[model samples]
Target: MKHQSTGESLSTYSPLLLFICFLISLPISAQDEPKISVGGALRFNYNLSSWKEGQKNRGGDFGYDMFRVNFNARFKGVYLNAEYRLYSDAFGGGVLKQGWMGYKFSDIDEIQIGLTQVPFGIQQYNSHNWFFNLTYYVGLEDDHDMGLKYIHAGEKFEYHLAFFKGAEELNFGSETESSTSRYSYDVVGRNKEINQFNGKFVYKFGDKAANRLGVSAQYGSLYNLDTKENGDHYGLAAHYEFSQDRWNVKAQALTASHNPKNAAGENRDVLKFGAYGAPYQVAADFNLYSLAVSRNIPVNLGPVSNLEFYNDFGYMQKQKSQFTDSYMNVTGVLVTAGQVYTYIDYAAGYNHSWLGGNFKDDFAAGNPDAKWEARFNINIGYYF
Candidate 1:
C-alpha cells in the first residue's frame, strides 16, 4: 500500500490485556488524597485535498476523528499513566496509545516499564504542526514500543536510556498480526523490531535564551519470522531548541539505516513500514532534517485566549541512487480558547506518504517528475 490513512482489525492480548484493563478504571472525584485524575478529548476533522479529486470535487468530509481517555494516578512513590483511544471502526476501532506503571526513586530519577515513548530524537515533538515532521512517518519521532525506560534530570542535563524487547503485540489469535493499524510505524509483514537500545542526553545552555541541545542514538535487531534470523537497524540524531518570550524554534538532523534479512528474492533496498491500517515502502538508508518556528500570541476573541502561527518544513534524502527524495511543508495556525483547541494547516508534500504517493514507491523508488500534493485541514478538540 502506498501512503494512505486508515486502520484495520486489532488483535486480542493475554496478560497485557489484563494490565491495560486494570489501568482503565473509573474516574473518581478529585480530593486531597493520593493524586488521581481522569481527562480526555473529543476531536473532529475536516479536510480538502488536491490528491483526492473525487472528494475535493464533492466537498470535503467533516466528521468525528477520535475520542480518548487519559488516566493518571499516584500514591507515594508508585504511579501510573495511560491513554486509550476510540476511533471509528474504519480506523481500527480502539487501541491503547500508551500505558505504563512506574516508581520514583528520587527527585530526579525514575523508571517506567510497559509501553513507553522511545528515547530518541526530540523529547515530545519535532514540529509545531499536527502532521509533525518527515521523521515521524518512518517511526523516528513520537514512536513508542514495549520497553523499560530510565530517566534522570540534573540541574543542567537530562538523560534517557531505554531497552525495548520488541514491539507490543496485542493479539490472541494464532495468525501473525499485521503491524498495520498501529499508531507508530514499524517493520511488518514478516519482520518485527526487537532488542533495541536507546540513549539520549540533553544539555541546557544559555539561561537567558532557554536553549537546549541533544543527541540521540539507537540500535536494534529486526527479526524476520520466515528467516528466523536477525537483521539490524540504527538511528542517530542531533536536535536543538531555542525559545524566548513568545517565540520557539526547533531544528533536527537525523540518519537511519535498516538492514533486514528478508526471505530470499526480496529486495533489501526498501523496507515496508505499516501503521494506521496501511503499509508504505521507504529507502533502507536515508537522512532527514527538519526546521520549525512558532510565535505564541495572546489574543482576545470571545473565549479565544491564544493563537500560534508557525511553519514547519522537512526533507528526506535517500542514499540509494535509484530512489527519490521527499519533502513536506506545513504552514498553520493554532487557536486556543478555554478548553478548546483548533489547528488550521495547509500541508504540501512531494513524493510523500499521507500526501499523494502510491504505497509501493513514494519513498523508495525515484520519481523525478513527482507532482506536489496539498491538503487543507482543520482539527478541533475539546479537552476536559
Candidate 2:
C-alpha cells in the first residue's frame, strides 16, 4: 500500500517539475539567442518652388526644408525605437515620430509600450521602404501618442490593438471665436481633447506562383469629444510577382469616415484608389516608371542614389452639399549620398466655388466665389 501511494505522488509531481524546467529554460534560451544591435537613418529634403493659378498653396520657397532622424536598438526579445523630425517653417519644430519599447514572444506575438506609431495600416508596418518607387497619400499620419499594443501573427492572419490620445495636440479654444475659428480649433486641437482607441486586422493568401493578396481594416474612436464622434477606415491590397522575373504588380483601395473635428476637417464620403507595376533589370541600370492619383502625394524620387526627381498631383470634384472644388500640382527633386537626402519642390494649385446655393448658405455664408493660391517648399533630412 505504501509503495503504491508513493508511486502516485511521484507521477503527480513529475508534470509540475517539467513545467518548472520549461519556465527556467525560457530566459536562458532567450539570452542565448543573440545580443542586441543599434542602428538608424537620417533623411533630409529641400524644396524650391513657384506656384501659379490652378494649384494648391504650400507656402514659402528656399527654406531649411524638413529633417528626419531615427534611432533604434534591438536585442533578443526587447527593442527601443525613436524618431525626430524638423519641418522647415511649420509648427512643432522638433517632434517625436515613434518612441517605443517592444517585446517579442517567439515569432508570433509582440507587445509594445510608449508613444509609437498607430498600427492601423500597411504603411505603418513598412514605412522604412524608401527604395520602392511607389507613392501613396492615404496613409496614417505618424502621430506619437501614449499607447500599449498587442500583435499576433500567423501564416495567414495578423492583428493589432492600440489606445492613444485622439488628437496629437489638445485644443482648448477660447470663447468669442466665430464658427470658422471654433471649427478650426476643434479640428486642429485648440479645445478639449479626447482619448482614442484603434484596432486593425489583416489576412493574406495565394502563395503559389510567387503571388499574394491581402485585406486590412482599421477603426478609431474618440471618447471625450462633445459629440463623441468616431472615425473608421479600411484598406484592401493585392500583390503579385512572376517567378524568375523582375516584374511586380500591386493595387490598393482605401476608405475612411469623415469626422469634421479631425485635421483636414472636411466631412465627406471619399474613396481613394491606387495601382502600380514595375519591371526592372530589363534595362541597363533598372529604369522605372510609376503613375498614381490621390488626395495627396507625400514623397517622390527617381532611381538615382545621388540625384533624383519626382512630382505630386491631385484633383477633387465638388460634392452635392459642398460648394467648392480643388486641384493641386507639385513636382520636386532629391539628392542623396551617404546618409543625407535633400529635396526641392515647386507647387501651384487653386480652389473654386459657386455662391448663393443652399450649401453655400449653410456653410460659407456667401463668403466668396473663388480663390487662387501658390506655394514652394524645400526640405532636408539625414539618417545614421
Candidate 3:
C-alpha cells in the first residue's frame, strides 16, 4: 500500500551537512585531554529462502547487512557519541543512526539530549537473535527518536525516562518504491508535531543481576498540519529474564493501540508503524509475545572460543479479524572468537510473520494463504 507524497524534497547536501557539523565540533583540550575512541562493525550475510508459489522469487543471495562506524569522546563528565551507517539499498543507504551529547552524573546516572533510542519496550541489545524481536518491526522495540532522556541505575532498580519530539525523517525514494524509509518510517507523518513520552522500569534480582523483570510504556500525540488531523497512540509491555550458569530464558508481552484520524480510508497517510507497513487504521490494536532460550555449549573448535545455541519464537495476534495473525521461529548457533562472530540459522514463518519482509499482499488480495516459508542464513561479522 502506497500514498501520495506531500512534503517538500530534502536538500541533496543534507548528508554532507551533518557530516561537516560532526567534524567541526571536535573537543579542544587544554590540560585534561579528552579520550577519543573509534569503533565499528562490518557484517556479511548469505541467505537462501523458500517462498510461496505465488510470491515473488527470493533465493540464494549475498550482501552486506551493515557497515557502521561509531565515534565517542569523553572528557570530565561530558561525552559525545555518534554512529554512521553505510547500508544496502534493501535497508536504506547512508544515514546517521545516533548522534547525542550527554553528561554523566555518576557511574550509573546520565542525562542525554539529541537523537537516541525510545525506551518503550525490551531493550534491543538484550535479544539473542540478530534480527531482534518482532517488536522492532512494529516500532515498540529497537526504534530510535529525537528526544531528551534521563537514566538512573541503582542497586536493585533501573529506570529510563524520555520525552521525544519525533523520529528522524530519511526518505530514500518515492513512497511507492521499496525503500528503507517505507519500512522504518516512524509513527508520525510529515508536517506533524508529535509529542512522545516513554518510560521503562526494571527490578533486578540479586547482586549478580542475573534475573530481572521490566515494565515499559509509551504515549504519543500527533498534530498533522497537512491533513489537519490528530492521532494518538499508547503502548504497554512487560518482560522477564532469568539466567543460570549455562542457560538463559527471556520473554516479553506487548500490546499497543494506534488511532489514526483517517484509519478507515482506502488511500491515506500511512500509519507508519504498528504492524509492518500497515495502512492507516487497518489494525487499530496489536498484541505481541516473544520468547528466547539460549545455552552455552562446552566444546570449542579451532579459533572459536565460545559456542552458543538459541531459539526464538514470536507471535502476533491481530485485533482486527481481517488482518491475519503471524508466527515466526528462528533457531541458530552463534560462534565467537575475539572480535569475530558468526551465525548459522534456520528461520521459518507464516503470513507476514518474519521481519525480513511483509507478506500481507495475499490477504489484501482476498486470497488467504497458509503456505510455510523458510530461510537459511549464514551471517558473519567482525568488530574493530
Candidate 4:
C-alpha cells in the first residue's frame, strides 16, 4: 500500500469526482424537458318534454351530463393522442367511449390503431377540442367501432379508410335446446358477428371564396348470414365553408339493407310466449338525410370570442315486409345567440311516424296509423 492505485487516487480526488457528476447529470436535465399537455371538457344538459308515447313528464330534467379527458405527447417525430369520456345516463349506460394511438409518417400520412371513431362522416372527423353544434348535426351513433384506420392529408385534399366490427343483436336458443346445453348464453354469445370497410375523400377550393367538398363510400358484410340476409350500407356527404366569413353549409345521406333468415312460421308461437326461439326474419331497407346552415359571430369578452347560430333538419325512412311501410320524419333546430360567457341554445323538435305508433301497441291496437312526439332542449356551456 506504499503507492496507491490510479483508480483509488481518482476516487479520492474530490474536484475530479464533482466534475464527473456534473457531466452525467447534464443529459438527464435536458431529457426531462416537458413534452406533454393535458386538457378536457365537461357538458351538462336539461330537457323538458310532453310526448304521445311512453311516459309523459311535466317538469324539466337533466338530459346528458358528460365528462371527458384528453392527453397529448410528442418528442422528435413521434406523437401520441388519446381521450376518455364518462356519461351519466347518456351514451348507453356509460361505456368506454374512445381510446386509440396514432403514428405519423412525414406530414402527409398517418395510421391509427385501437377502438376509435370510424371516419365515415364530416361530424365524426371534426376535432373534439371545442364544444360546438357539429356533434349534434353530424350524427354520432354509427361512427364509433373497434378497428384500424389510415389517413392522408394534403394542402387541399384528405383521405381516410377504416375497418370495424359491424352491428350485432342477441339471438336466443329454444327452451328444448337450452335444457341440453351445459351453460346458459349471454347477449354477447347470441350476437351475430359482422365486419365493415369504409373510405372517404375531401377537396378544398383555392378561390377567393374559400370552400371545401367531400365524398365517402362504405361496404360491410355479416359472415354468419346468407348473402341476402347479410348487412350492407353506403353514404354520401358534402360541405361548403366561406373563407372570408363565418358561414357554412352541409348535407349528408345514408342507406342500409338487411335480410335475416325467415323463421317466422317455426318460431312465431314460441317467441310470443317469451320462450327462447329463433328471431323472425325481416327484409328491410333504411335511409336518412340531413342538411344545415350555420354562422359564427364575433364577441367582446375574455376569449368569449365566438358565437354560432344554426338550424338542422333530418328525415329517416325504413321499409319492411313484416309490417306496414314504416317511416320517421323529424326536424330540429339549434340556436347559440349569445356570447361565450353567456350563451343559450334552444332546441325544439317534432317526430311523426307511420307503421308503428308512439306506444308499442298504439298501431297494433288499431287505435291509429300515425303517432307524433314533441321535445324541447336547452343547454348553456361556458369555460373560463
Best by TM-score: 1
Q: Would you estimate the TM-scores of all the predictions?
A: 0.89, 0.53, 0.80, 0.62
Q: After superposition, how far is residue 154 of candidate 1 from its true place, in Å?
A: 1.6
For candidate 3, lDDT tens digit of each residue in 49-122? 77543333544777878788999998755688988877765455677777888876678987777778777766
- Model 4, span 1-384: residue lDDT tens: 143232223433444345335433432222445488876656667555554233334376765455667777755444566665555432332333455656666589976655666676564523211222222222223345555678998878889887755322222322111111101111111113236677888787766436667776666543322122333334455443333477666665665443333233432100110001211222134455555566677766555556665555455443433333232322332333343222243333222211123422221121223444444455544321
| TM-score winner between candidates 1 and 2 | 1
Q: How many angstroms is residue 378 displaced in model 3 relative to the true structure, after the best TM-score fit?
A: 0.9
Which has the better TM-score: candidate 1, or candidate 3? Answer: 1
Query: Top model by lDDT, which number?
Result: 1
Q: Higher-TM-score candidate among 2 and 3? A: 3
Q: Is candidate 1 or candidate 2 better by lDDT?
A: 1
- Those runs of model 1 whose alpha carbons end farther than 4 Å from true positions after fitting are 1-34, 172-178
Candidate 2: misplaced stretches above 4 Å?
A: 1-46, 52-61, 66-69, 74-76, 87-90, 125-139, 153-156, 169-187, 190-195, 203-216, 223-252, 258-320, 327-336, 344-380
